[model samples]
Target: MRDLLGRPADTATLSVTDVDAVLGEVAATTGSGSASRRSELLSDLLSRATAGEQDFLLRLLTGELRQGALEGVMIEAIASATDVPADLVRRAVMFSGDLATTAAAAAAGGQEALLAFGLELGRPVRPMLASPADSLDQAVDGIAEPIVEYKMDGARIQVHRDGDEVHVYTRTLREITRHAAELADLVRGLPCTSVVLDGETLALTDDGRPRPFQETMARFGSTREEQVRALLLRPYFFDCLHLDGTDLLDVPLRSRREALHRVAGEHVIPGEMAPADAAALLESSLDAGHEGVMVKDPDTPYAAGRRGRAWLKVKPSHTLDLVVLAAEWGHGRRTGYLSNLHLGARDPDGGEPIMVGKTFKGLTDELLAWQTRRFPELERGSDDWTVHLRPELVVEIELDGAQTSTRYPGGVALRFARVVRYRPDKDPAEADTIEDVRAMLRG
Candidate 1:
């Protein structure tokens, strides 16, 4: 707590990262101890802290919420305060399900006990790889490994059922079983004693295709339950994990696809096992006016936690790696300062960067300050709160995932594209080509 707020004399010198590290180490130390003892310690600590502090502690301890509270920062703070190597702290975390146990175990037992946590809750917890670049070339290169691609829709869900009981988890592994009771009844009819299936839940358009991601997100927060009911969400199964008591994640994509196709039927968003030509698929998708397809390696097993080259999504044309040049003030939590951004990209033919659009959706409070501090250094100048900058950073953006507009230069504008993340490593010259933007406009 002292470290988080930097309460004491010397602690004030500690940076934000230093504070994060201190908290993580405490969590890891407790994780390395007896489970009961660690739990009690966590309970006590949690009780004394305000609800906000508890949330911060949870974010610090768990490896989640990395934008501000990164693992490196957390490790540094803990190591400095507890005098432990950051690596040991990381190893301890991988061993224990929770930080309290991880801290205690690292402090008490060695890696031998830590390595025994291969199977968690009778289901294994593996390092999940992130999805590779959502580009055609990337998908084609992965074809040697038998790739299959599906629609990159909104929600990724995992459904687990043992007899009458059922549990549904979101992509982040949060239990959201209560949020979608309709899905439970749908899963009940499946032909298995116990099963785990991985798929996406999407809001469908009136014509039966999946609706835009915006509609899907908005449906979740609607206070009118009737409105939510009116918005139909169907599960499009792409992979099968557990059939009966057998875990299919180890099975090859072909075997899993066969099993998934057989059981999931129309519910499964079909992906061909054949590694078809990427350009052909891209053309078909663009013509259909739908988001791009996901290319998956047919031989690859279900990578539970990993996003790797095993799967690649090919999005529709008309996206860019634009730099955030300026921002406007926000309301509510962000009362003043740049909350929204005016994005820019390198000149289409080479000159000055043209204004792309503005977005306020992706940034969090902590991220806002981080940007507020960092952007000024890059800032070329400012008109108002909309500060202009030298085009340096690039962001991977997505639209409806294809839409046309005539509001901007280039004789076109983006439909509903928004920031995914800032690509610091990518050079501005490498921002999306104008040809790609034209392809997007065709739709």
Candidate 2:
């Protein structure tokens, strides 16, 4: 923008239509002719844009445009604009997997158009989500018959197969079929002619133990055949949304499990229906090197894109008292607060606290305010983003587990670490040592 518009003080002359046309041309330009054509289109766009327009374009292109409107707000706006129920629009967006498409459908034909959206083969539908539960008993307290399944700590996958052609997508609906050809081939070998299955995929060791989360994620980043073969991912499907030609979006859990069992066979995740021993199942899952268990209501329909109480995830969290080394300045709603704590484990050899990991989760408004005021008092030095503080404060941190990491001096990092509370009674010398944190990897 600076190259083309160079200190132009002229009033804004570009309209939305003008910018949209250039963007359309840029989107359509492809193959060997794309670079020069896209450059020309961008040059033309900047020539007509004012300084303010150029600034807006830059932010929009770079995804730094931070208006206050979120997805929920946009759903409400769409409902109001189309004179349709918010629930209907949200459901449509969930199934269609595109908010813009849902809004256009609602505008074109109202409720009828929104209702027309269904589970389409080859098009990814938003996967259902589970809410966190403190314990297994609490998760199944009100439910009559709970279906508990092992919750794998891996990447979420939504696989769709239409005859021989198969496609796999991530939880965010990004197509990864090229990188997941082995998974696609396995889907093609399923008994059904066509299906949509929701599951998790992860790399495993020779003994079938799941690898670290980072190793599983590394398989998704490369397309080299040798690399893909070196770290093969195995799929463990838990839900069957579409089987053969019938759509099971509105099917109950019991019926969906039957379908999943019929088509998935050995690929199905291990679970028991209305287990008399839910706690035993959870223990077995953890013992098998899996995450935890997902307790689900048997009668509830699969509600995609919604984190309702129909499904609840229970995992035993491990907590440790660690020293606070530093903190980073917060952003957005936490603009002035000192958030994102730099957690460190005490060195048994009496050296400086060894950095393990950092976290900003589980902090309330009161905690944020207290940290902002308190950290500055103990600050030893400062940088543009981080405030280095004296290792005088100890905080209790809850984590899922620890993994081997080369990023920190401790050689291990916390996974899903969150603040439990500040340990005012514990001295820094009494904090959990780096050896204690690394012990999680052994188990």
lDDT of all predictions, in order shown? 0.62, 0.89
lDDT of 1 by residue, 1-443 (tens): 32233222322233456555544554676444556655555555555455555555566566533344455466556555555666555544542435556555544554444444432332323233346464667666736654455564567777777887777767656666676777777877777667777787877767666665656656555667887787767887877776766767667877888887777788887456564565676566555445667777777765433345776666644457775656665544565556787766567688766666667766766778877777778877776546676677677776653333356665545556666777878887888754455555332
TM-score per candidate:
0.58, 0.87
For 1-443, candidate 2 gives per-residue lDDT tens digits of: 34544454377888898888899889999999798888788877876677767776876776865555788789999999999999899889889998889988998999999999888898998778888898888998998889999988889999999999999999999999988888999999999899999999998888888988888887888878888888898999999999999998788989999999999999999898889999999999999899899998889888765558888999987999999999999865677889999999999999999999999999999999999999999999999899999999999999989999999988999998999999999999999999999988723
The candidate that wins on lDDT is 2
Residue 308 lDDT (model 1): 59
Q: What is the lDDT of residue 392 in candidate 1?
A: 74
Assess the local accuracy of residue 99 in candidate 1 as a C-alpha lDDT between 0 and 100.
55
Question: What residue runs in model 2 are displaced by over 4 Å at the alpha carbon?
Answer: 1-60, 65-70, 224-227
> After TM-score superposition, what is the CA distance of residue 70 in candidate 2 from its true location, in Å?
4.2
